[model samples]
Target: MKLFQYDNFPQVTGSRVSLRQILETDIKDLIEISFYDAIRAETVQQAAEMQSKINQDYLDGNSIHWGIVDNANHNIVGTCGYYRGLDKGEGELGCVLLSQYYGQGYMTEGMSLAIDFGLHTLGLKRIWAATGQQNGPAIKLLERLNFVKTADLNDDEIEYELQK
Candidate 1:
């Protein structure tokens, strides 16, 4: 599929959180996540590599990443976005939030807005999300959004697809 290029990016928000395109100003937030051990423990990846991957994704047309911010405190508490791959009109959703915000449902709100932008604005037909089978919260969120499990790709990971 061809890459979708935009001269300007868009911002999405909800009552508890707001999402803006990742910018240089957001680097500090990324750095903070890089040093958060809990994030690494949950995702099973090192910070340096993950940080580099985030930056590279912005430079390339392979993904659109955003800063998920806490509205009341105005602090960036997580990251979310659609990685550009798979098939045309299809994308993937993933997010990493600070441990403190786990039970607040902030991530769910951010992702719902993202899904709307992908479908209504970006003209996406299908969006899929993959998560470790052991990650109950993620699986539940995807299921809540009606993303169906297609198969077990490997290990504890399951693939989900949303067709428009």
Candidate 2:
């Protein structure tokens, strides 16, 4: 599918948090969260750069990305987005959570909304996501959302997909 804006991104309310589109001011919060872990610095930097580009893309009509925020504190805890894939019916899903919010159910809640929005609102037939094989929490969350293992590229990463 073609990339688009998440201004219409699903406004899902869970027990503790909410999901909404990524905002321009969110860049600073993202910059802060991206620096939380030393070992992941290089990887985080690359991801941050990609996020900046995606933010611009969203602004320019290229894609949809959303910020996962805590409803109570109004703090951004993570991001999720759908990048256009090679096929009309396919799109890529991705997300990252702040270290402080790790182990919380936030990512799961956010990703569920993303997938639902992609399928129902965005008219995507297939949504896929990949994560480092060692990212146990992400893997578990994706699986919980009914994302099935579609490919195992290597020991380092696994590809998952959900078909509508």
Q: Residue 88 of candidate 1: its Cα lDDT?
A: 70
Query: TM-score for all predictions?
Result: 0.79, 0.76
Model 2 per-residue lDDT tens digits across residues 36-129: 2122334545556656676566666556667888888989999777755724666788888988899888888888887777777777878898
Off by over 4 Å in 1: 23-53
Residue pair clashes in candidate 1: 133-156
- CA lDDT of each candidate? 0.74, 0.72
Candidate 1's residue-wise lDDT over 1-164, tens digit each? 33666666668878888988665555654664553322442232454456567656655666777888888988787888887553476788777777777878888888888899888877787888888989998888888887899889877789988755
Best by lDDT: 1
lDDT, model 2, position 11? 66
Query: Which 10 consecutive residues of model 1 have the lowest summed lDDT?
Result: 35-44
| Model 1 Cα shift for residue 84 (angstroms) | 3.4
Q: Give the best candidate by TM-score.
A: 1
Cα shift from native, residue 70, model 2 (Å): 0.9
**Candidate 2 structure, TM-score to reference:** 0.76
